[model samples]
Target: MSAPDTNLEKQERRHKPSMIALRLVIAFAVLALVGFVALQMLGSGDPIAEELETGSAPSAAVD
Candidate 1:
């Protein structure tokens, strides 16, 4: 009778990320970036709204 190999312990397992999980992450990131840019660019058709402004303005004088 032939003997079976007992070296299965020496074999390494390949690591891989779940495709579904990765797809979800990529989708979410892309959607978030698109939404952010759209909000900033289009201003949601409200010129005075959705404009999260930054920086300082000149001080007005009061006499």
Candidate 2:
């Protein structure tokens, strides 16, 4: 038996709705991660200065 040659028509590929939604979700997740990192970098203060201002040892108990 011989297989039929069904490659006569070249079909145009279209983006699936689920694929588009997945891409959008991935893009938003990346953006969110970048924003979180940016906020962390921008909001971080000097740890030594904070410790000095607090005037307490790191392991000291506070009453």
Candidate 3:
């Protein structure tokens, strides 16, 4: 019984490192996805479209 328990514990220990690495990878992936979505939401727009709708171009000359 003790021998079997030790074997089980060793297997669990072997799996722990991989599990931690997998969790870290998943966390980074989620973080990257969130950042990408935020950037898209904040930056999504066509300046040309806005200018077309407003029917104006900003003057480059400064008084």
Candidate 4:
């Protein structure tokens, strides 16, 4: 058996606010962009009415 060396050290982790803020901003922007594109694809009409007009049952529940 060998003697253990006494060179142990502890590290303190630090958080960077600027990087976190940038990542959050990017995530929100991407989500908003995807949401906008989805809405555009759905078009500017009553979705259920459109589906009914096309002779298919509305896939979503009506309020």
Candidate 5:
């Protein structure tokens, strides 16, 4: 009985580090995906140029 319990404990200990590493990889992947999406949203510079081309600049002098 004690031998079986020790074997089970050893198996669990062996697998723990691998489980932790897998969780870390998944977390990093999610963070990278979020950062990619954020960059896509924030790095868009073409719309401002389009607005400028359309002459949509606000006037400084108020009549």
Candidate 6:
């Protein structure tokens, strides 16, 4: 078991998001879906959809 050591090619990350950003995205998506479902179940005509659709949740972008 040996790795290739002959003229290794350089690999660059281009336009890639960070791990924290990815986790935030997934967490937000799940939370939005869960909130929407909960809203539908309550039958109070709440405006949870507004928050989800308007991207009001806390999130940040990493460089």
TM-score top scorer: 3
- Which regions in candidate 4 have their CA more than 4 angstroms from the true location? 1-15, 46-63
Q: Model 4: how far is 25 from its true place, Å? A: 0.2
Q: What residue runs in model 5 are displaced by over 4 Å at the alpha carbon?
A: 1-7, 45-63
For all the candidates, what are their Cα RMSDs to the real structure?
Answer: 9.7, 5.8, 6.4, 11.1, 7.4, 17.1
> Can you tell me which runs of candidate 6 are displaced by over 4 Å?
1-17, 44-63
lDDT of each: 0.63, 0.74, 0.84, 0.75, 0.83, 0.68
Tens-digit lDDT track of model 4 for 1-63:
864754334211234566688899999999999999999897768877677778898676789
Tens digit of lDDT per residue, candidate 3, span 1-63?
A: 455455877898899999999999999999999999999887558776667778998545568
Which candidate wins on lDDT? 3
- Candidate 2 wrong stretches, greater than 4 Å: 1-15, 45-63
Residue pairs clashing, model 3: none
**What's the lDDT for residue 39 in model 2?**
89
CA lDDT, candidate 4, residue 39: 97
Residue clash pairs of candidate 6: none
Per-candidate TM-scores read: 0.42, 0.49, 0.62, 0.47, 0.56, 0.43
Q: How far is candidate 4 from the true structure (C-alpha RMSD, Å)?
A: 11.1
lDDT of 1 at 22: 82
Residue 13 displacement in candidate 1 (angstroms): 14
Each prediction's number of clashing residue pairs: 0, 0, 0, 0, 0, 0
- Sorted on lDDT, best first, the list reads 3, 5, 4, 2, 6, 1
Using TM-score as the yardstick, the better of models 1 and 4 is: 4
